[model samples]
Target: MSFLTLLRRVAMTLLFILLPAASGWACTPVFVRGQASTLRLNVGQLTVPADARPGTPLYHKSFAWNRLSDGGEQWIRCADDPHGLSPLLLDSLLSGGVTRPTVYQTNLAGIGVRVSLRAIGGYGCFPDRPTPSPFSQRVDNPAALPRCGVETGLFPPDD
Candidate 1:
């Protein structure tokens, strides 16, 4: 079967096994490999917009994928379905289509399993804007903008 198809199957199985018990937990479980660290984490229900260039992928509604490393939580936003992971994703994750997201992972949702997230293209491409700005402040730090092409390893928006 295709990767996404297989992922869906896996997600369903995981949901059947995990959600019944962990339903009360604040986050859901998701598995990952080859990341050189923890493979599983509790995925939360919270979702926010994908922080990327306005017209970029994942610029739409995005879901957060949580990972616990060194006993701390790290969040990675993801895209909606058809990318492998549709299960484990909160209802909000599948609702919106804001940013244009790059297919970063084959498994986009499917928490409580080894599914990857595709809406996760907003790494360094998203700037960290300082101060409390409105939605207009979509980009990250202005000074850090240069880092996109240099340190952060991202191409210019115009490109």
Candidate 2:
């Protein structure tokens, strides 16, 4: 066979053999801190369900930023599911977009609010490999962001 055809065959073989071993997914989590007299964080969109009640999980992708200003930290867990979020997704939510961590302003419920976001870390990358829990029993700084749960070596966050 010609050199070109032989190279093609080898490449294809490597891809098939490596793809499964290299393929892994993860969920990235972001920490959002809001600063405003009355800040409210809304992810995705606001939808009122018929079963809406006090103290119940809203069953929506949105989060409440109102408590952020009270020395509270909010976490946006990343996942392949619709309820999860990522830095790229947050960037797209802005009027233009943000490339790096910067203070941003947006209107919520007709009120101006300022906020900042950072990717704390990622988790659930290797389904087959046993990993540590993302949460810690003791958080040194409740306001500080948490690090990634799983150790992602040589692989980037796909999910």
Candidate 3:
């Protein structure tokens, strides 16, 4: 092949490689429990008090995620459900690009994050109840993303 053709092919290859990292939903809060291959959780900052006890979840920064994605995710950082979630707010967060305040709160410090999304089934974690509990539930947001509970890929975006 000619030099021009070779250069074009190399350029295309490089684009594919670097595109993902660049296109990744940057600046958005993602807490991957691998609970579900594609169960994308948009959560808030976790505040575990210095005097808090073990085996007890102080309180998670109320997270939200929907199957819809048009742009970036809007997360409420450091606000631990200070005010109850209103129906309107819930609907907005569960609909499309989040429009809430911008704050950074990633809490993946000691938690394990599953890198693959092709798991046969989703990781069973109870969002309503902490682990080591007798209760466990699957991702069931029928009203929002019907397919959010299904696992399909092993990478970021398009999972």
Candidate 4:
């Protein structure tokens, strides 16, 4: 082939290789940190409606509790089927001073899988009775509490 023809082909090939990469830059994933906590469960233990195959990884921004100013709490559960966790199980934990626990789980193939539950933030109001400590004492600092953050495999069992 002629040198000019070869040069033209090389330039076209290079453009094709870089076109997709340049376009993808505009569609970057946005991750919101410290936004409202939401439950993320893996596909295991709990039965999926067979229809829920797989979906794209959800991008989270931030997490907020019910009562940020007041005494409120949030939780995250990570497990195979966090959604399947019984209310009683959660109630038992809450009774002990746990609230709004965030749950997360890894995507399991079919049978049992691993899961984790953690408290993200909490707040409490002060007592109205005659006490040495003020109501501010009743409120627990969320930042002081432990943070639960987990990285799980992507949906569809692949990235």
Candidate 5:
């Protein structure tokens, strides 16, 4: 091969080595469990860019739940772009008129978070009897528990 051809091949090889040829991607499974009952649930997985920096805003189109044993799941998605955080608010309804919130964290790059659910309002009062409750019971808007805030100087694991 000629000298020019050899130098061109070497330059191309170095470019490929330095740049990532494939997209950087990461998937994490977020589990949301009800606080009022024994029913355990897993929220939909989050597929985010692996190199997502701070203050990156992403949207979750829709999140649905599947019936587990006796209880059902009610979920809501909330985002906070100012704080670089996004989490799903989950409520699990069980027999005997019990409801609780379960929060799932998706922005895994930041500091660890503590999630909780609180009752805002409900349609009907708690039942007096211990028999199976009636349908059509609804809870008013539930609020997402406050996050402890992100810790500075924290970075995600390199994979």
Candidate 6:
């Protein structure tokens, strides 16, 4: 039992214990009644709005995620989204970093988000929606995105 070997064992044990907790603590948005919900990310916790109302705008100035990594804080909002989706927080979870914006539909009964990516805009429950077809069968076009019965004329940037 060398001192260096003991140190290594302790480090490995710490890693094994901390890794799962780190992942479990990762920020995730909260949804209410199948509608888009907002969350606040602090040091190591995500806080969901206590008074969230259904169908209201999900993103607000105070609630928006501030990109503090850069020199100064920049507020990411829905209206000026270059990516076409608002609230910006839900982007990665919903899209899975895919080129096309992933869509989830709220159930007819409005119980929760459906498992299927059947339509765009979370079936209108989501605040943002891409425009109807102009992009067709291309890797970099609106047509590539899933089209649904309801369209908002909003589209993400090409490629």
Which prediction has the highest lDDT against the true structure?
2
Off by over 4 Å in 2: 26-71, 77-85, 88-159
Residue pairs whose backbone atoms clash in candidate 5: none
> Lowest summed lDDT over 10 consecutive residues: which window, candidate 6?
108-117
TM-score of 4: 0.17
The Cα RMSD in angstroms, rounded to one decimal, for candidate 1 relative to the true structure is: 20.9
TM for candidate 2 is 0.25
Winner by lDDT between candidate 6 and candidate 4:
4
Q: State the C-alpha lDDT per candidate.
A: 0.29, 0.35, 0.32, 0.33, 0.32, 0.32
Which pairs in model 3 have colliding backbones? 35-123, 43-63, 117-154
In terms of TM-score, which candidate is stronger, 1 or 2? 2
Q: What tens digits encode model 2's per-residue C-alpha lDDT throughout 1-159? A: 999999999999999988887635455455554432433344455454556443223222222333333554343444444355333222332233234222222343212222333223332221222222221122222233322111111111222
TM-score of candidate 3 versus the correct structure, residues matched by position: 0.19
**Candidate 5 regions with alpha-carbon error over 4 angstroms:** 1-55, 65-71, 74-107, 111-159
Cα lDDT, model 4, residue 32: 19
TM-score pick, better of 3 and 4? 3
lDDT of 2 at 89: 28
Q: In candidate 3, where is summed lDDT lowest over 10 consecutive residues?
A: 150-159
| lDDT (C-alpha) at residue 23 in model 4 | 56
Model 1 lDDT on a 0 to 1 scale = 0.29
- How does each model score on TM-score? 0.16, 0.25, 0.19, 0.17, 0.17, 0.20
For all candidates, what are the clash counts?
A: 23, 1, 3, 30, 0, 1
Residue-wise lDDT of candidate 6 within 24-88, one digit each (tens)?
A: 55434322212233332232322335564443232222211122112322223223233332232
Against the true structure, candidate 5 reaches a TM-score of 0.17
User: Which is the better candidate, 4 or 5, if ranked by lDDT?
Assistant: 4
